[model samples]
Target: MKIGVLALQGAFYEHRKMIEQLGAECIEIRQLSDLTSNRFDGLMLPGGESTVQGKLLAELGITEPLRNLINAGTPVLATCAGLILLAEEIEGGEKPYLGTLPVAVKRNAFGRQLGSFEYTGSVGDLKDFKMTFIRAPIITAGHSDEVQTTAVFEDKIVAVKYRNQIGLAFHPELDQDTRIHEEFLELCKSFSLNK
Candidate 1:
């Protein structure tokens, strides 16, 4: 399967490497042509500055097409700031970017860079995986019918799934464990087969 990693900024390279290690073709999407010219089975929106990424997507003419693909049920794995982008609502009245996932997220809910930390937690049925949070967001609430909380930390929602899309408040790409990536690939495979 082929996966596109939004390479405008942040941890995109890590996501690309993880996807490639999982035996899939990884494409780095940096410009408008990358999105328009390539066909991908899935897309990875890596952890980055949500505002900057949002602005770049629009400036590069990628926002609408990418949003359309996501809304069309293309599988996606979004982490950290990517989670903020996918949220339908953001805390403190910030405008959502993609707004594909039916969840409300609060940016930097875990505090700033100084508040960054790591913990071993379970993601859905996946257990004891290390999760790293760096200025992460938290899913404060979700649309019960459309979203399911898959993981939690300290009573805070850290991961959620809506259809083929998964939004993680922690960075799974920063760890050695590949289970999360594997799960995403599985989603991509299922999506491909169904398509």
Candidate 2:
């Protein structure tokens, strides 16, 4: 299946490489007008500065289109700052999120970028995956009925799945494991088939 990576900013190129390595067509989306239904089977919002990314989305007038895409059952895999963008609410900031997932987020909860570290945890479909957090946010809690935690760090939920949306608080692409990407592809397949 084809996957679209929001290339607005941050480490989106790395996500593109990872997806392409899995033999899937990867499309780099720079603007809202590039968001066409036929271009990809799923979308990946990469890790970046949430405040900047949020402003960029609003400036480009893509907030509603993206929300509509999620509403229409399009699979979305968001990481790090992308995770913040997917939250229903964000603490310590006024930036509004996409509110696609039933969870709250706190940006830079793990300390500054220099305080980043590598942590290993188990997820729902995959276990013992190594995750790297660079100024990552934390998924404090989620709705019991809709949450499927893939991993956690220091007792805080770091990775979760709500419906077709997968939110991760670390940079999985920066690591050697492909399980997360594979899981995302599987979610995309399920979403495309309307499962």
Candidate 3:
């Protein structure tokens, strides 16, 4: 399977490495041409500044096409700021970016860089996985019946899934575990089969 990693900013390389380790082709999506020229079985939006990534996606004319792909059921695994980008609404009145996922998020809910932390949490049926949070956002509420909470930490919703889209408030790429990434690949495989 081929996976596209949004490389405009943040931790794209780490994600690419992880995906490659799983024997998938990893494409770094840096420019508008990358989106048009390549076919991706899945997409990974890595942790970064949500505002900056949003602005760059629009400026590079990659926003709509990427959104269309997501809407068309391309499996996406979004992490940290990527979660904020997929959120339909932001706490404290921030403009929504892609709004592909059906969750309302609270940005930096864990605070700033100094507030970054690591926690072992239960992710769906998987338990005791290491979650690394770096200026993460928490899903305060889910707005769609299709949306399901996948993981929780400190009573806060940290991971959610809506159809083929999965959003995590922590960086699984930074951790030693590959369950989340493997699960995402399974989603991609399922989407490919259905298509």
What are the per-residue Cα lDDT tens digits for candidate 2 across 1-195? 878888889999999999999988998888876885454679899998888888888899888888888877889999998998889878765656688888888778889979899877677757778889999899876855778877878788888888779999999999879988998898888766764
In model 3, where is the ten-residue run with the lowest total lDDT? 186-195
Candidate 3 structure quality by residue, lDDT tens digits, 1-195? 989999999999999999999999999998989988998899999999999999999999998899999999999999998999888999999889899998899999988999999999788888899999999899999999999998988889999999889999999999779999999999888887778
Instruction: Choose 1 or 3, whichever is better by lDDT.
Output: 3
lDDT of 2: 0.85
lDDT of 1 by residue, 95-185 (tens): 7788888889888997899999998978999989899999999999987687888899999999999898999999999988999999999
Question: Where does candidate 1 have its weakest 10-residue lDDT segment?
Answer: 141-150
The predicted structure with the larger TM-score, 1 or 2, is: 1
TM-score of 2: 0.94
> Alpha-carbon error at 41 in model 3, in Å?
0.6
Q: Number of clashing residue pairs in every model?
A: 0, 2, 0
Candidate 1 similarity to native, TM-score: 0.98
Give the CA lDDT, 0 to 100, for residue 100 in model 2.
85
Q: Report RMSD (Å) for each prediction in the order shown.
A: 0.9, 1.6, 0.9
